[model samples]
Target: MIDSCRSKADFAALRRGRRFDSELLWMSFAADAGLARPRVAFALSRHAGTAVVRNRVRRRLRALFREHADDLAPGRYLVGTRGAASAVTYRRARAELARLLETAGAFPRIKRTPT
Candidate 1:
């Protein structure tokens, strides 16, 4: 399961982390050897939209993160939503996030076996 980054230190550390950006969102990642799973935090500025819009986007992003939690590397991720993110469909958002994570090498390669 993915954990939420709740501590001030965790958020602070993201400032020093490697960053990746896309039209929908920008992300920062910092590897942590002590982590058993990926931890994430979200940021949405007022420019994103009204409170309702921001919450909707946050919920969508959270669901997408949960679906990919197992694939993610052990790290802390800070995800900031762009205005476009508040307007996209869930499928498009998912696609963008997948591409972003892939570009960041956040998802490790898994071997497959033929049955």
Candidate 2:
């Protein structure tokens, strides 16, 4: 199993000065302090829906991310749902994420500083 580097600080540190829009959600790799592997922090705002709906959105995004973790290079990613994401299937989500990754300059080379 992929070690989950779940930590509140990890997510918090990522949001310090990062900026994003409807197009993508991303964060660089952050050390778990507790675990060596990088973790993910998804951002599904209340604007997305009610708690039940928000949880469902997160759940779906998590499952989709879990399914495609292998393709994503190591990073403490912050995922935000774009306008397209609201209506995408799992397959579409994966493809859209891949496209975003490419657009974000994440591929060809994933830049990393000392963590």
Candidate 3:
């Protein structure tokens, strides 16, 4: 199961971790020595939109993150949105998030055998 970063300390640590950005999102990641799966937190702010819009964007991102939790490396991750995120569609969010994960090199590498 995907873990949630529920403490301020954990969130602070993530803030100090490596950061990545895209047109739709901003993310931070750091290795979590104590976890076997990645933990994620959302930091959507009022700047993103009204309460309804922010929650919608947050939920979409969380869903995308959960779908790939197993594929992600064990770490503490935080995803936040800018003013533009609320304007994005689910498909765009999913595709952009996937690209962000790839840029972070967070997915495990697969070994191939010569055939």
Candidate 4:
């Protein structure tokens, strides 16, 4: 599945719905079993870094979502990077993102495969 997010209407739903925040990101989710499309908005403000740094942060965060989209709930999510995200590596970013999702209770606990 592709990580495609479009339209202001979808995002408006999340913002007006339930919300959660971590040091690394912000999440807005709602329980809609009726099926609303999944969407994401990333916020990398100028205060986060210079142009080059900001873009790099954006790329890394987008990649994390692209790779881990299945872990998220089907709703609008806005991942806003705080000032500290610029200093972290890609792997660290991934960990932070996972932690954020877990804290939000958005990630379902995965079953372990027995050898």
Candidate 5:
């Protein structure tokens, strides 16, 4: 299950973890050996936009993470965004987020051949 990073320490730890930037967002993630599931937090700064835009961005990020929570490695992940993120479509956000996750080694190595 995908859980929220509720503590300041956990957020700090993720902030210090692996960092990657997509066109629309920034992602920081660190693998946790002890974690039974992945935890995630979204940081939409005031500079990003107005309250409505920020909340929209937050909702999209959370949805993207939750939808793929089962595929992610056990870790603490934090996603942040700038004003540009507010303009992105859900499809683009998901695609970029997936790329970041893959680069962070969040997926298993299982492969399937083309039929």
Candidate 6:
């Protein structure tokens, strides 16, 4: 199961980590050797929307993260929404987040055998 980043240190460590951005959101990832599972946190600015809208966006991101947890590296991730994210459809947001995660090397590279 996916875990939530709850420590202040974890959040602070993201400053030293790699980041990937998209029109809908930005993601930061910090590899932690001590972790067996990935931990994630979400940040939504007031400019993104009202509480209800922000919560909806947050929920969508969380669901996407959970759905792809097994494919992600063991690390701490901070996902923040952009203003555009407030109105994005779930499919569009998923596509954007998938691209960001791929860019950030969150998924392990698959080695191919010569056929």
TM-score of each: 0.89, 0.58, 0.87, 0.76, 0.88, 0.90
Q: Rate the local accuracy (lDDT) of all candidates.
A: 0.85, 0.56, 0.83, 0.69, 0.84, 0.87
lDDT of 5 by residue, 18-112 (tens): 89997777889988878888989888878888888888988988899888877888889989885665786799888988999988888753355
Using TM-score as the measure, what is the rank order of every candidate, best first? 6, 1, 5, 3, 4, 2
How displaced is residue 48 in candidate 2, in Å?
0.6
Least well predicted 10-residue stretch by lDDT in candidate 2: 23-32
Per-residue lDDT over 1-115 for candidate 2, one digit per residue giving the tens place of the 0 to 100 score: 2444367766666666244333433334432344434366666676666677667667776786666555555456677664433464566666766666565443433456897
lDDT of 5: 0.84
**Between prediction 2 and prediction 6, which has the larger TM-score?**
6
Off by over 4 Å in 4: 34-37, 109-115
Steric clashes per prediction: 0, 0, 0, 0, 0, 0
Candidate 3's error at 37, in angstroms?
A: 1.8
Those runs of model 2 whose alpha carbons end farther than 4 Å from true positions after fitting are: 1-5, 16-36, 82-88, 105-115
Q: Tell me the TM-score of model 3.
A: 0.87
lDDT minimum window of 10 residues, candidate 1: 80-89
Tens digits of lDDT, candidate 6, 22-92: 88789999988688999999988888888888899999989999889888888999999777556777998
33: Cα error in model 3, Å:
4.0
Using lDDT as the yardstick, the better of models 4 and 6 is: 6
lDDT of 4: 0.69
Error of 2 at 113 (Å): 27
